[model samples]
Target: MEELLKTLNNIRSLRLLAKEIPLEQLETILKKFELVVQERKEEEEAQQLVLAAHQEKIEKYKELLKSEGISPEELLEVMNLHRFNPSQHKKRAPRPAKYKYTDLDGSQKTWTGQGRTPKAIQIQLDKGVTLESFEI
Candidate 1:
């Protein structure tokens, strides 16, 4: 009974010690987290700058087209169709299992190419295939 009481007391003491975290350590951890957030924010800002540059280039292209007697409507159509946005497209399609294809090493390798049915990928789709098949 005395040994059990001592064990309980030791456990309680350990719990008390565990709760006593240093402010400096916490501040350091918080500082690291803040740094990560700042880095991510900077990366996003840089991406915005790149997109702005792309817009500027498109404007320049529009100007060039205008000089060549092309109408603004034609330029708008081209820009609308060709504008790139990374987030707008799906990265990959859902897969039930990884398709293992033979690599250079003669070993079974997972499919690196994007698509649903790997074997059914057609370079030029027939009229039967919808335009939606080309998306993402």
Candidate 2:
């Protein structure tokens, strides 16, 4: 890997290696490199086409906004007003416990009944006990 990296990084090393390689093997390597280059060029051209399409749409929107007597800056300000502000939003408070039960180790535990049932509660539930029996 290191030798490959050194050869790639140094033009002199690359030229020397290329000169030593058999013509047939060199032709095969060249063909593969050319294919890779063509693929990359096609990918770049596709991306450029997408960017051009986006630009065209943006221009059309700008013209529509102008016809409606609204400047881009004004539209941006209105959009910003409705945009979410994490600092201004408060996190919701945690839900209160809905059920209380004794664990297998004889310790009291509480659950909000939101997610998976506790193993201790599940064991009793499997034995025909009602889930409501553990209600807080």
Candidate 3:
């Protein structure tokens, strides 16, 4: 992530260096971003492939269940929680838990994460600290 940010900053600096960055330079940066996007798309495609394979296994299991006279719904109930996105496994962290609060003065507010201020704090962030106190 830091490397990506550095690359972005370097690209911005390069753009600023030119009196007017040429279309070719812009295209180059666009191409880099496009490559990243393409990679993500491919990841999603691979996830779909895994999902298909899992579904195929489930179908085979269904056939076995049929042999035992099990109802389709019963089989589905047994496997309901196994349906998960393969793409999600390699992606960003899960969203933080959210909480809504009303202050003593009757103010309404909501925050995310496990902290005093609910901005969806990351694990590395200081726990239970309000946003104002976070700077320290």
- In terms of TM-score, the best-performing candidate is 2
TM-score, prediction 2: 0.59
Per-residue lDDT of model 3, residues 10-70, tens digit only? 9666556554767888789779989999999999999999999999998998889899999
Per-candidate Cα RMSD to the true structure, in Å, reads 20.8, 5.5, 19.0
lDDT of 2 by residue, 87-135 (tens): 8999999999999999999999999999999999999999999999999
The lDDT leader among the candidates is 2
The candidate with the higher TM-score, 1 or 3, is 1
lDDT of 1 at 89: 85
| Per-model TM against the reference | 0.39, 0.59, 0.37
| Model 2 misplaced regions, further than 4 Å | 1-6, 91-136
Structure candidate 3, residue pairs in collision:
111-118, 112-118
How accurate locally is residue 30 in candidate 1, as Cα lDDT from 0 to 100? 68
Tens digits of per-residue lDDT for model 1, 1-136: 9875664469676456446768787578669979999999999999999999999998998889889999989867988888887779877865543344444445654543455543333322333664354343
Error of 3 at 30 (Å): 1.9
Scored against the true structure, residue 107 in model 2 reaches a CA lDDT of 100
Q: How does residue 30 of candidate 2 score in lDDT?
A: 87
